[model samples]
Target chain A: MRPAEADGGARPVKEVRAFIASRGRAPASLLDRYVAGFGLVMGAAVVGRPIASLLGGLAGATDPSRAGAGTALVLLACAGYLALARAAGPVSVSGGDASWLLLSPLDRRGVLARPARLLLAVAVAAGLLLGLGLAAVLGAPDHLVWRLLAALVVGVSATLGGMALAVLAQASASWQSWVTAGVAVLVVLALVAASGQARPALSAAAHAPPAVLGAAAGAAALACGLLVRRALAALGRIPARALLAASTRAGHVATAAVRLDPGALTWIAEDNHWRARRLRSRRWPSLPGPLALAWQDWLRLARRPGRLALVAGAAALPAVLAQAGAVSATAALGMVGVLAGALAAASSGTAGARRDGDNPSLARLTGVGRGPALAARALLPALLAAAWAAAAFAGLALTGTLPATSWLWGPAVAPALAAGALRMARRGPVDHSMPIIDTPGGAIPTGPLFWALTGLDVALIGCLPAVAALLGGRMGDGSLMAAQALAGVAVLAAYVLRARRAR
Target chain B: MYESIITVTGLTVELGGNPVLTGTRLAVAAGEIVAVVGPNGSGKSTLLRCLAGLQPAGEGTIEVFGAAPSDEGPFWRRVALLADEPAWYPGLTAREHLELMSAVHTGPSRLTVEDALDVFDLRSRADAPPLNLSTGQRQRLALAATLLRPSDLLLLDEPERGLDAAFRERLAGLLDAYAAEGGTVVMATHDPLLAAHGRQVSPATGGVPA
Candidate 1:
């Protein structure tokens, strides 16, 4: 055993970290400290007004009709947070630390302490947001301060417990199953809440006395503390190989972020998922050349049934939001959310196009003409976007946010969404050399900005008719739908034709 | 007499103000195999890229199929280039990748997916994703994908990379069989066994036959 392992590893690990830190770059100068402090102050100043306004909005009694949907939304958001935390390897070090320290004979818990603290900080911030959102949604009928505090306590406890559960899941398979079950339960509960079956309970909780609320918060906090203790103990038991794999994934994510290349993140996730999966080879379906080439995307989408179900489930989110009075307040926000969700759904089917764009050796080997291949590729995304947007629109219309015929807008704009998704997939890495223009607020780096807007630009331009009609409450108009369909088809055809001429 | 499939004369490539290949000359005919052997940074891959019309030569004339090579669909239909391992499509098994290759071509594949898996000794792991395979296995999968499709000419860069001695020899025979089927191959190789299977040339010596 190494020397560090002799005396429980903690002291040695600290000494080593300090030694490395001392040998590292100079400490921040006074000016650097000043700038950081000034930035924080300015940020707080900018965020303060909106937060105050939001708090003011939380003063009234909860709207009974909106209570169930609001509660469901809150539950769904928490579930999403937990899932993201689990996926991110809630306990992971930076690439440098992972390389140098992770495999050493230090106390595993000691090595993980910094990352654990970082996770805590992130969880706390997210919990605060969740708390604020809950307070705003459920409303404080009286004694706003005490109710808000209770809500904050409950939110923090829930996220802290969820985060602790995620950490435990990393160390134990049994815990992983529990986390999965928990997320499933949350989703089911959300559906129940959205259906208005939970209104009585939600209404009672919203108007509960401060003493009862405090007791519930106390129970939650106790559970959170126990889970956290278990998680801290479990840290030492996490396998080295698992930690290494998670660290490598985190390194790739960091690299992608540093490069401002969001597209690379999808590939990283894709490759990681497949690397761990066991798959049986299936015979390729007989199809024409370009269609055969495009069939991989279809096969890929079919393979991930859970993801498809999640996408299907998310179609109800717009209606839920509208019922919660969030989307109904802003028509533009509602339309944007629908379009964005459709584009994301479309993007899920464009992995094959993305792979070819990154490295076209397979594409070249296939030897399919670009136009025909692209046209074939567009079919799946267009179909996916069409279905997703239509479902979302139907939900919104049922919620009285849109007209009865509003679902027609979904298919009309789907081709453009598909075109946008394909464009996004093929948009290569961000070019950092693009000019940065100075603005009053800050210097705007056009490189990443343009990279981000590349696909959205096409989608927005193509879906302009739909956007205008939705905003104008003209979804019942037949002419606008016809115009949107024409525009969508034109955009997709133009994109494919241009791609054919490229290279 | 065999028809000439490719001819290059006075080929020069400069990258970032440095010459990688200077005054290179090469000629290949149908059913011929030429191995371009050179040290690292000797522009072997660059020469292959030029042949595929992917790299722009600073000064040279490269004629493939009696026309300047073009990086377009029709040109690729007649030529297959396997340099670095292509990014395998996610969620695809090794056999599935070969199947995709066979499915996407109108012409008959040289080897069926099952035959390729058996020949490449990947039958056991054929159902696994290429990412999960060992480096040599992934290389074999790439080769399977490359050769399974129909092409008149093959450009292979370091085809022996990540292969064991036994597999390398088998690959040499496979290339011979490919050439025997009235196709042309120009590969860059570090393995003497693979190089000796073809007319050995070096980019250092302007790609002249050695």
Candidate 2:
């Protein structure tokens, strides 16, 4: 046995004692100990017969095979949540205080261990509660309790595995947070949906034969969780909070040190990595220096996963939906791209305002006049639009709905509305919310311009086919009209300037 | 005493329908780096912002150049701002950023983006994305970019904040040089050293140079 595993696999007391003996650690704080006890007791008793019956009869409800399906579902849920966390862990945890925690006396492993355990226990308890509810509601038969028990156990593995994916992603800064959860759900759901469709017997979740089915799910979950755990360990010490000293890098002159701005940290995260990755000896009959700038944008586009996904969805959806004889994939994709950006832009624009932080002078800077700078400043939402566009297209294609003749008009209309949205974003003492969370009456601060963007987008759709016809892009029907209208918008945007605070 | 180059008339600001900065008139002139001394919520930053064109004045006139803000179209090209908090595009490199800025200008008279990079000792980091640069480096970059602007008027809010003595002294020298070259500078700081170097002080809401 491994020496670390030698102590009875560590009962609560033995674990604490070993830690204290070796490193002079204290027991859990009074609040923590009490919370721990509360959790353990809560788990052990809820699984006790009487409570389980009252809660979900889940413990008493299932046949073994049926229990297996539920076990898979629970694992699926855990995995979903974990992936959500890893993808979008806040860049600034509480605006940068968490980074400071690294310097405290707490060792990283020891510090993370309790929280991870607590999370694990919580996952199991949640699964148990869910299972019990199902049993109570469905009047599950007696043989199913063992299945339920196994399902809960399996859930622990699923939760850890999913969470591990997220943690790894976040630590590596590999992807945007919003997409992380969506991707995880889509993956798990695709599996469950596909399998459930093919074999109805597998989804007879209330029926049960034995605990083996649940146990298999549990094993799969456990393996995935273990993988995530190992990945986190391999990521090494990030020391995210350790401020980069100017000395390590040139141009960090003695004259410019300030409290580490979170913005700077983000810049450092990209800048340092990029520099390290730069080719020491780049040789080429390179493209003209002036045009070379586009390569940077190309690289940026390639790196952004959500953007690619959105593009694929928008492009594919019409074809997919047409095959299924559904709604117009073109209209659907257009709306998706516009609305998502419309919603996301408000929040991002507000964030921009907040970061701008009362510095009205930035408006006065001549650099703000550049088309590209304006574009970059408003990029967060533009990409949101792009993602929406891509997804809409892909969904249409998948559903077989694309109008065969209207294909070429897709790229033209997407960017036309996008350019309009970009224009509106710039023209703000950016009208947004004081409490900018998404809620009733808490959506985008509504006004004239909001309606204008909406109207403009709709108008673009109305004219698409005409514009396509003018360009001779091809269209079988007048329905290609919307592309014509979107094409027309490009002209309006070129002539009309977006308003900003007067200098 | 520093003369007033930026002037605000009947300026008012509100947050969540509550007044944060009232119809407060203020002015700052060329060669003035005023340390806006204040306790935390005293509107020091808000005042700087009115001049910066960040937060809108609920009801007032802010003249940046010889014209009111409503005519600020040309005024923006000449202004450089370093917010109390840094602002950057996460995806763009430092060099790309300069390129973007240069695109807005009608071909600046001097200070190619490369020269500014060399001045700030940022040549090595020129290709580094803004997000990857250290705080000090980013701040220097922001300053260098701000300095490169052709606007005779310079407005820097809390520019010296969070800097060690070495960096702080270097900033003072840069300011002195800018003033010698006939540029207008309006820098806000809380540091006593910055105040002393500027030969003036302003209350959090007060605007007299000294």
Candidate 3:
């Protein structure tokens, strides 16, 4: 700890603190121009022409199916918004922002207000756009001017309502989370039960006069103002730990969405559940390391009722469809084949595969290098997928939809799908460091590796059809087996190439 | 009967475009313990990582058992590394993590999950997930995981990190026992107690003489 050395070490940290003190951020000029350009583009090519066409089409057409479909879309969007708010908390600051900005001696209100205002604006804009899109689809443009105004009013109201819920969740996490979840679940049930009925609340807003709609909009705005005011006040008292946790949760949610693994969402939600519960036990049943690891992964996945239910629900879909006479047993099996592969690929039960790259030490220590490591992780997901495929195919066989040979495909395809998934999980989010690619319009914040991985993942899905075609077509076993061997080799080659790049 | 297990010749490693290890050379033999000692940011951990094959050598070469370090042959199967920041799954308990290591590692160790939990004094919180574990507890669990896997060569970065004085002494005892069983160890450490037990290799000064 020489004085000069200490000073040298401290210099970068000092510079960073000074930079934060200045509150200097990137120029917003480009963002402003981009927003304006978007508005102009929408006005010319999207909003104007679509509205006119919708109106003309509605006037000529007799069926009101479009309106019903529009209503469903709006309801689905509302459900999605509520779901996001419930899961990801309202306000978030990165680890740096939490330390440098939130915990700093700056005016907390002023600092929080900036992002709050941006979020409010974005929410309102998204709501308005969605409403307009719905309105055009519904072809409810009899009083075109007033109808659009009404749609805007409804948008403002719904957006504000969602924001108020989000803010409340941020302010009081435990209570707000539970309450919001209950309300959301109830709303979903009610909507599902009365799905076919024309929604009265939505109908009134669509047909309401400008003055009445404006009054409703004004009331919603007032509610939002009150909520925002209270939320900002609460922010001052909110723990730094809570904010950090929220930020981490938001990051997980964002990453999970990108990865398209609903199971990852379960990981976040269940983590919160575990933290909240803090259940402890000491009962020990010793097993070998590898068996124990697999057992643990299975327990982690199955213990979360929500996740298990979701997976089981996915598995049950084809059976439900067949029972409902929506499709024949044969069609159900075909549908199940594709969906099962997808669900298998998407499942995060395979912890070894997903976490192997992130923890090279574990792999090195355990002597489970890439291929063996991936196989170990993929075992559970493959079994689960195979089980689901088997059940679905059995139904088809019982209904006399296929020969007994169809059962063989499940064992073969599930493992292949699992391998593909293991390949995808081999690269974690850490491997995808955020690198901004500069474009003429703006900078795109994404890793080049992410784009490459995404392309490869999609291409992997494309290879599934070859297997399917072989199974369903009149190809002989020798030729079909040869084709399968070639495909397997090709996949193995790709996996090896990916591993080399990773190194 | 002494045979070199790890040999690094003119090794150079750059992390984030900054050279961490430059023209560093070292060798460690079977059943021997070597300490890679250095001040902070002096490439002790980097050298260990290179030896364990977790890091790619920017220049020169690294050989473990007379084979390229990067090669995933039988040599790698006999090697184990405990990294600086030990990784544990968020959903897994400390005990479960050990169980997982037990399942994945098929080398030679006869360490049981209960034995590890008892040794680390993690019995109380064995069922608690990583989110609940303290920094010291996490480090202990990581060491416990390493024990679950039997290896001929062990590379540990800051083995005594986040441990108490008593635990450091215990760790020394454990390493001594491991060495008595004919295992080779290379630890990146600042602890004099741990360092004294090994042939000190200071890579900052271009490595120690074999």
Candidate 4:
């Protein structure tokens, strides 16, 4: 038995923490506390006006046509929040603490107390935002303050309960299934709301009296309290192995964030996912040399059918936003969103290109010319981007935002998206040596700004015709569509030829 | 009579203003196996990299295949270099990686995918991703991928790393077979047994044949 067990038990958590603190950095000074307080005050001052304006806007009845889509978006956001919480361990420590303190025979509850508090703070903050969104979606017809308070209570309760479920899921297999079921139910509810089937019920709840709202709020708070208590009690029961794995993942994420290298995070996530999976080797098809090298990306995509479905499902988000009156095809924000989504879909298949850009050892072993290899690799990304954009455009047509023929623009713009994805993958690390430009707004570091804009510039230039058509409300312009197709193909072909010349 | 595959005269290299190799001379013929053996930080790997055209020599002349070495696809097509543990293509099994190697090089591979798996002792773990394999198994997979592809010259850095003693002996036999097929090899190694299988040379002695 361990020495701590040999004794009566582990020391009090407070005393252990105190002992550790003594050997660590000096305590925060008065000036440090003052700066922290000032920063918080400044942040609140900056954010307070928009929040108040939003709440003021929520005081009246909402548009009935937008209610369904708004409700669906709110539900989807909650589901996404819960899923992200589960994926993130919802309970993880820093690298130093996990390595030095987690494995020791100390009080496990004490060891995890800090992360638990952090999770709680994050959940609370997210719950507040969710509450505001919910209030906005289901506007108050009477007693606006009381209705808003009830919404806040319900939102906080739901998030706290979901977070508790995630925590329990990490410690036990059965709870994990429950959390999965909960997310699925939320998604189904979102679909039901989006379909307008729940319109009557949503309308009734939006105008409900203060007494009814207060009772519901009280019940939600009681349930949230119970789940929070249970989660707190179960904190010490979490397995060390699970904790270690989660902590290591968090460490990688922290490192990536600190270094401002978002590229590393994708590899970290990919390596971790494959490390746990069991794969069956299949015979490689007899293809040309460069095509053979590119086949790995197709195989990778095929292996993750769930991710494929998720990407397909995400294609409807633009239409959903349009339906909710949040954005329009003619708006800059909406166009940017559609283009960015297509680019992201395309980038999902460019992992092979990214891997080669990061490390050329495997590429060298393959012995394929860079230009041919890149051209071959672009095919999958183009297909993915085309399919995703087509689906999105079809959704927009259904929403009456664009003509039915707009779907043809998807394939027209796919080559440009593929080129952008490939360029983004090969952009390498953020060069911190670039000059920082000062503007009236703020000082912008050109390195990260340039890194962010590298692929986007190419994509924007290639898609200029489509962008112009959309912004000018000329969706039926056949000439612009043909121009988009020509521009995309020309850009991709030029990029490939340039790569050949560069070699 | 043998054709000269590589030649270096009075090659000097410095890193961070420190001399690692100075006035090194070496000559290698086709179908020959030459092992660069030396202690740590003695420029063994540097010489191998220089030969593979990956590292630039600070001064002096170096030639491979009767031309200055270049890092390009055509150069790599004729020369295969296995230095560090390569970043494995994500989501690919060890066996599939070997299959990919065979598919990319239209020329006949030295070993079929199945034969490479068996020869490298990775047959049992063929379906496992390289990330899932132990250090030794991953190293074996790397070696298998390197050897399965067709190349005129093989540059291996620390081929014995993470391999069992038994596997190291097997690696020696594999290298010999590769040479027998008229492929040239220049390797950096610390394993005496592996080095003994070739013409051992040390960078410390200005790359004179030992």
Structure candidate 1, residue pairs in collision: none
- The sequence of per-residue lDDT tens digits that candidate 2 reaches over residues B1-210 is 555577787777887887776766666577555456556676777776777666777888887765554324455555666775445543456765565445445645246677878766778987776656787777777777677666666677777755667777877877777777766666667777766766454434444444
Worst 10 residues of 1 chain A by lDDT: A326-335
DockQ of each: 0.87, 0.16, 0.37, 0.86
Worst 10 residues of 3 chain A by lDDT: A58-67
Residues B1-210, model 1: lDDT tens digits:
899999999999999999998999998989999999988998899999999999987898999999999878899899999999898999999989999999988998899888998999999998999998999999999998898888999999999999999999999999999999999999998899999999999888998776
Candidate with top DockQ is 1
lDDT of 3 by residue, A1-503 (tens): 75535553344445555677688775579769887897688677867786566555543212243344455446556666766765565677655666666765454544455457766886787778666755554445356666665566666666666766676666775548644664566456434423435545545545666678568667866775776567666755556666677778877777777775544675567557766655443333455444444565567675666766656545534433333233453353455454444446345566555555555655556564454444445577667656666665555444444445545445445545555656655544523457778766556667644643642463355346434543465223445544554564455455645664353
lDDT of 4: 0.90
Selected candidate, larger DockQ, 1 vs 4? 1
How many residue pairs clash in each candidate at the backbone level?
Answer: 0, 98, 6, 0
By TM-score, the best candidate is 1
lDDT of each: 0.90, 0.50, 0.64, 0.90
Candidate 1 ranges beyond 4 A from true positions: A1-9, A439-442
Model 2 accuracy (lDDT, Cα): 0.50
Please write out the lDDT profile of model 4 over residues B1-210, one tens digit for every residue.
Answer: 799999999999999999999999999999999999989999998998898888899998999999989878898899999999999999999999999999999899988998988888888999999998999999999999999999999999999999999999999999999999899999999999999999999998998976
Q: Chain A TM-scores, one per candidate?
A: 0.96, 0.44, 0.62, 0.93
